[model samples]
Structure formats: structure tokens, C-alpha cells
Target: MSFGPFLLLALLEGTVMAAVLALTAVGLSLVFGVMRVVNVAHGEFFMLGAVGAWFITYYLPLPPGLAWLVALIIAPLVVGAIAALADVTILKRLKYDPEATIVATIGLLYILQQAALTFYGPDARPVEPPFSLRLQFPWFGYSGYKLFVVAAAGAILLAVWLFMTRTKAGLVMRATQVDMETARAFGINVDRVYAGTFALGAALAAAAAVLIVPIQQAHYLMGHDPLLLSFIVVIIGGLGSIRGTLIAALLIGLSDGVISMFFSPTLAKIIATLLVAMVLVFRPQGLFGARA
Candidate 1:
């Protein structure tokens, strides 16, 4: 076994996997931090975004890159709209009932899943990289498109961080997350904040799905792995902290990549899950979480 190839593969997977983890977990963090609602249908939104992007790119005679771009931009907006509608119509009504919020999202998850199945069937559909850019990276060669995804995900994450830290909207979001009543008292429209935050979280999930579709393909149930992974990340990172989520995501991504490189992927996943379980038992606030 050539250690060099395995090392390279591990590095590649770690990098991209971290991006995926960040994308998926950030949304979960946002929802938890601000709205205090767990969206069971988050994965379904990811699937919806991927499928929606695929259709636009494939059926519209657009260039492959353009198609993916369309998916990247449009899918998130569409999913965000759906989320906003749900927030206004359902979640808002049950603001005081956390259990009801969970149940409602679970119901939405099933509806979205069934709708995806009915439209795309049960088979997994592969989506090709928009263009062939044979980029040589000194030792590790990769398709130009995968490189694009890596770059795009990184840029998006940076943008999100900036938005959260620098923008007025970000301040408002933080205020809402910390205390809705206080934010409302301060003249911020709490309802608007909740709706916008929910939409933003949904959009983030959708955007991640768009980025991942080329590698994972468009499947009705494609969101399952991401959703599960996101939950694990949030738990490991501390429920509502973006810094914690980012750190834990990197930890999990690197751990999974190295484990898979050394052992079978299946076994690696099992080990990862065990590690998470142990972490939860020992450090319920997460590795990066502040001790409450």
C-alpha cells in the first residue's frame, strides 16, 4: 500500500468534507441559536436544492457551469422561500411549543421526502461536473469542477462569517438568538428576525446541497447523510456557536478522512459515531462549547 496516495486522498477528502460539514452544520446552528427550533426537514431542503439545480441545469440547455451556478443561487432562494412560508404559517404559530415545532418539521420532512420520491423515483441520479478542467496540483490531480466546489464553499463560509460578525443584520440575528424579548423591546421586529433567520438557515442548507450535487449526485434522499452529519457536528460543536461548529466540523472531517484512509470506510464511520457518542457523554456542551 502506497502511503503517498492514501495521504493525498485523505487530505482531499478532509478538505471537501470539512466544507460540507460546515455548510450543513452552520444552518443547524443558526436555527438552534435564533429560533430554538430543530428542523428535521433540513436534509429534505438540501435534497430539494440539489434536485432543483439539476433540473435547471439539465433541462434548460444551459452550460454545465451555468446550470450549477443556477442551482447554487436559485435552489437556496426557493428553499428559503419555502422555509419562510412554513415559519410564518406554522412555526410562528407554535412559537411557545418546542415539541410542536419539532413534530411539525418532522411532518414537513416526510412530505418533502415523499414528494421527491414521487418526482425523481427511488434511484440515485448522477450529476456530472459542469466542465472538464484537468487541473494538476503538483502531486494530486483533480477535475477543475471539484476544485471550484472547494473554492466556492470556502468563499461562502468566509462570507457567512463576515455577515455574522460585521453586518447589522448579523447583530440583529445575534440579539434575537440571545433573547427575543429583549430584541423586541429594543425595537427590532422579532417576527421578521425569526422568519429571516429561518430562511437564511434553509438557504445555507440548499446552497450546500448545490455544491455537493456534482460529487454526491441528485437523489431524493441525498440529504440524509448531510442531515445526520450536521446533527453530529452541532452536538460535537455546541448547539449554537458557529466557531464551535466550524472547529468540530474540521475535527470530524479530518478524523473521518484519516480513519477511512487507514481502515474501511464503513468501520471508519462506526468509529466516528462511537467517538461522537463518547464525546456527548463526557462533554455534553461539546469540545469547543463553553461550560454552562
Candidate 2:
């Protein structure tokens, strides 16, 4: 293959990475934007989704497509419910104190991780793709499922944007994000909003995990890299900015894919870290975040 085709392949791979990362980072950004709480366990929720997918498909006596469809719907809901429960039980009790919530979520992360390790076991497992067709490019063939991942993520993101921009629920969430006390004054249920937002964020992460698990194996420890990369994306794109998150995910994901293809994964990560540091030094508010 020529360099052009090779690069095109890299770009396609990067788009897949970007699609999943955008969903995960947007979830993180949304939680912080509305609740003003950093969810350290967000990644674990993602891991749980992957494990859930594995369990659902592994045990279900359905056709591969049907099983995948079922897992896709159930996994996110389960993880979201767990997240909502944690918010009510732990974060709410602490009054969502910034420092306290951080510590609490860190604890939650360990708890979920260990729980997964205990039950899900340590082996990495792969789920069969919902479809097996491959699209042939001039120089090579690519997984149709991977292309579907990109499309699915895009469709989900579009739905999210529409929900946030056009729905009453989105308005309430935005209002809460702007001023929790004022929104409460206006008759919004602040507690309920917080719980819902947390759940929504976890659901997004889980959804991303489900989309990517077919390509990447599900493992208890798989959350670590996504978590780290999400933080980087959120920081570079500007915390709480969905548009920024998308842009940053593309930049980081494409760079990582191309660099890893030509060089090393470690170098790609190092470059991303450095980019985050530079962004922090120059634009503390993030690329799209408003100055506070």
C-alpha cells in the first residue's frame, strides 16, 4: 500500500478512537459541568458496561445480532443505575463538596475495580461484532463494524446535542449547570437533577464501552487508559465544553492512531500529556471553556 492508503487507514482507525473517546469525554465533561464534581469512577462505569456486554452476550441464548442489541441496551442502563445509586448514597451525603466528592469517587473507583476483578475475572474477552461485512477500499479492506461504530457514535452524539439544545429536560439540566441554587429557586429538583446528570454521564460512558468492546477486549483494567485519555481530552478541549471535547478527541485520537502506527503508543501518550500541560499553562480555562 502507498503512504496515502496507509495514512487513510490510520485516519479511519483514529476516527473510531475519536468516536468512542468523544462519548466518554463528553460524559465526564457533562458531569463536571452540571454537578461540579469530578467523577474518578467514571472509567469504572465504562469497564462495567464492557463486562455487562460480555456477560449478556456470553450467557444469552440469542442470535449474535440480537444478543449484541440486547447487551447494547441493557449494559448502559445497569451502569447508569449503579452510578445514580452511588450519587445518592455517597455524593449526596457529602453534599457534593468538591474535595470530598473527589475522594469519594476515588474510593468508588477502587470498589468497582475490585468487584469486577473478583467476579469478571482477570482475562480479557472479546465480543463478536454485530455484523461481519467488510468494506473494500482501493488498497485494502476495513471492518464494516468499525465504520458502524463511527456512525453509531455520531448518531448518538447528534441525539445528545439535540436533547441538550431542544428538550425541556436539557433546559433544566443547563439551568442547573448555570446556577444550582437559582435553578432550585425556580422549582427544579436539584437533588434529582444531580442524580440524573450523574446517571446520564455514566450511561454515556457505558454506551461508548459497548460500541468499542467488540474491537477491544473487555477487561477489568481496561478502564485505566480510557480514563487517562478522557482527562486529557477534557482538559485540552476545555472542561464542560461538549464542542471542545469533540474537537479535542479528534485531535488526540487521530494523532495517537497515526503516531502509534508509525512509532510507538507510549510516545503518542507522552505527546498527548505534553499537549495537556501546554494547554493548561496557556489556557487554564480550556480551549472552549469560558473564563471564570
Candidate 3:
């Protein structure tokens, strides 16, 4: 491939990375925005989704496409249910105290990790793509599934946007986010909103995992990098701004891709970490976040 083609390849790969990162970070951002809860275990939920997908597609008698479709639906539901349970059992009990919930979620992270290690074992496994088709460009061939990932992610994001902007449920969540006491005064069921928000966040992460698992293998430790990267993205994009999340994901993703292609993955990550530090120091509210 020529320099132009290679650049094109990097852009495509970057788009894929951005898609996954946006999906994951949006969930993290949403949780923080609405519940004011930092879910340290969010990445573990993502890992669970990948593991669940593998098991589902592996055991189901359906064909690859059908099995993947099934996995896509089931894994997120399972993970979201688990998140909801966690919120009800752990977070609610603590009354969603920021410090307490942080500690609780950290504990949840280890528990989930240990559980996965015990049950799923220590092997990295991949779920096969729903379909395998390549796009033949004049320069080179590219993954059609990757392109599909971008499209799917865009669709999901659009749906989420619509839900938040248009639905009554979304209005309730937004109201809760703005003022918990006022929302409660209005009989909005604050606890229920928190639980639902947590579940929705986990569901988004799981869906993202299911989409990307075909490209990346599933392992108990697979959550670590995504966790870090998602945090970075959330921080840089602004704490609760969906639009900011999307923009930051694209910037970080494309930079990571181009930098990694030219330099090294470690360097790319280091750069991202530095960017996070800079954002925290200079603009803690983030690019899109409003000053509190």
C-alpha cells in the first residue's frame, strides 16, 4: 500500500477504535452524569459481555450470524441485569455517596474479575464475526465487519440520543441528574432512576464489547485497558456530555491509531495518559462540561 492507502487504513482502524471507545465511554459518562457515580467495575461488565458472547455463540445450535445476533441481545441484558442488581444491593444501600460508591465499585470490580477468573478460566478467546466480507479498495482490502461496527455504533448512538432527547423516561433521568431532591419532590423515583441509569450504562458497555469481541479476544483481564481508555475518553470529552464524548473518542482514537502505526502502542497509550493529565489540570470541567 502507498502512503495514502496506509493513511486510509489508519483512518478506518481509527474509526473502528472510535466506535468502540465512544460506546464504552458514553456509558461511563452517562453513569457519572446522572447518578454522580463513578463505576469502577464498568469494564468488568464489558468483559462479562464478551465472555457471555463467546459462550452463547459457541453453544447455540444456530448458525454464526444467528448465534451472534442472539449473543448480542443476551449478553448486554445479562450484564445490565447484573449491574442493576449491584446498584440495588450495593449502591442503593450506600445512598449513592460518591466516596462510598467509588469504594464499592472498586470492590465490585475485583469480585467480578475473580469470578471470571474462576469460571471462565485464564484463556483469551475470540468470538467469530457475524459475517466475513472484505471491501476491496484500489489500494487494498479492508474489513467489512469493521465498517459495520462503525455503522452499528452510529445507529446505537443515534438511538441513545433520541431516547435521551425525546422520551419521557429520558426526561425523568435528566431531571434526576439536574437535582435529585427536586426530582424526588416531583415523585420521580430517584432510586429507580439510579438503578435504571446504571443498568443502561452497563448495557451500553456490554453491547460495545459484543461488537468488538470478534476483533479482540475475550479474557478476564481484557477489561483493564478498556477501563483506562474509557476513563480517559470520558474525562477528556467532558464528564456528562454525549457530544463531547463522541468528539473526544474520534480525536483520541485517530491519534492513537496514527501514532501507534508510526511509533508504538505503549507510546500511544502514554500520550493518551498525558492528555488526560493535561485535561484534568487545565480544564477539569472538560471541553464540553459546564463549570460547576
Candidate 4:
């Protein structure tokens, strides 16, 4: 392929990757933003979603599209519930102490991972796309479903932004983030808020997983990259800045796609690491995070 065609393909792949990353990372950002908890298990939630999607599509008698649609709706809910349960049983009991929660979530991560391995097995499984339409480019044909994935992610992100900015529930979450004591003084249930926040974060990861599982595959250990990339995005975009997360995700995604296409995937990752180091040294607050 010529440079133009290759570059176009790279850009397309990068956009898809970015959409998934933003979806997953935003959840992490939300959890830290509101509850001040670092969830090491966030990636496990993503893996769970992929696993859940596989289960749903595999067992259901419906057509591929219908089964995929069902998986999209159900997997995230299941992951969210699991997260809420963990919050109530583990993190809450630890009093949401930052250090303790980190350790607690590390355990949570192992527990979820092992459970997936035990039951879901070690093999990677693919979920067929709901629709298989291909869009014809001048030089190539591209997945219509991939474009839909991008649109779906964009819609979900927009909805999340609206929820945070427009809804009363969002107001409560924001208030809690701003000041837990003040929010509680005004009658917010801090404990419930934390639990819900954690669940929401996990659900977002699951949703992202479900969307991408068709392009990729469901595997027990698939959470590692999403976790690492999401953390990098959170750090670079700012701790709680949604806008920053989106922008950083785009930057990383495009760079990864183009670089990986032009050079090598390992080199792309190394560049990303170097970018993070630069961001840390030059702008410790992150490009979008508020100054501490």
C-alpha cells in the first residue's frame, strides 16, 4: 500500500483504539475523582465484561446481532454489581483508606482474574460483530461495525458528560468530590456515594470491553494493557479531568496506531512511556488536571 492508504488505515485503527481507551479510562478517572480510591481491579472489571460478552453470545440462541446486543446491555450491569459488592465488602470495610484500598483492590484484581481463569478457562474467544457491513474506501474496505463502535463510544461519552454536568445525581457526585464533609452536611450519603462511584467506574470499563471484544477477543488476562494505558491517560490528562482524559486518549491512540504501523508496537509503547515521563516532570498536575 502507498503511504496515503497505509496512513488512512492507521488512523482508522487508532480511532477505534482511542474510543475504547477513553471509555475505560474515563471510568478510572471518575472513581478517583469522586471517591479518591485507586482501583487496581478496574482492568479486571474490563476482563469480566469481555468474559461476560462471550458467555452471553455463546449460550444465547438468538442471532449474532441480537446476541451481541444483549451482551452489550447485560455484561456491564453484571460487572457493576460485582464492583458494588466488592466496594461494600472490602473497600468500605477498610474505611476507604487510600493505601488500604489500593491493597484491597489488588486482592480484588487477583480474585476476579482467578475466577475468570477457573470458570472461563485460559483460551481466548471471539465474539462475532453484531453487523458485518463494510464501508468501501478508495483503496480498501473498512468495517462498518468499527465505525459504529466509534460512534457508540462517542455517544456513551457524551451521555456521561451530560450526566455529570446536568443531572441531580451528577450534582451529588460532583458535590461529594468537591467536599465529602460539606456534601454529607447537606445530606449526601457518603458511603452509598462511594459504593456507587466504584460500581459506575467498573461498569464503564465493562462497557468498553464489550464494545471492543468483537474486534479483539475475550481472554482472562486481557486487562493488563487497558489498565496500564488507562493509568497513563489518567496521569497525563489529569486525575479527574474528563476532557483531559478524552484528549489524551486521542493523542495516545493516534500515535500508537501511526507509529505501530510505520515502525513497531514496542517502539510506540516506549514513546508513550517517555511522553508520560515528560508530562510528569514538566507538568506534574497533568495537562488538564487542576494544580494540587
Cα lDDT tens digits for candidate 2, 199-292 = 9999999999999999998999999998999999999889888898999999888988999998999988998889899999999899877886
**For candidate 1, lDDT tens digit of each residue in 22-117?**
887899889888888988888888888888877777786777777777778888999999989989999999973779998999999999899989
TM-score of 2: 0.98
Error of 1 at 198 (Å): 1.1
Model 4: how far residue 61 lies from native, Å: 1.2
What is the overall TM-score of model 4 with all chains considered together? 0.97
Full-model lDDT for every candidate: 0.84, 0.94, 0.93, 0.93
lDDT of 1 at 239: 81
Candidate 2 Cα errors over 4 Å, as ranges? none
User: Which ranges of candidate 3 are over 4 A from the true structure?
Assistant: none
Candidate 3 per-residue C-alpha lDDT over 1-292 given as tens digits, one digit per residue, 9 for 90 to 100: 6788888888889889999999999999999999999899999999999999999999999999999999989999999999999999999999889999999999999999999999999999988999999999998888899999999988998999999999999999999999999999999998899999999999999999999999998999999988999999999988888888889999888888888887899999998999899999999988777886
Candidate 1 TM-score to native:
0.94
Q: In model 4, what are the clashing residue pairs, if there are any? A: none
Where does candidate 1 have its weakest 10-residue lDDT segment? 138-147
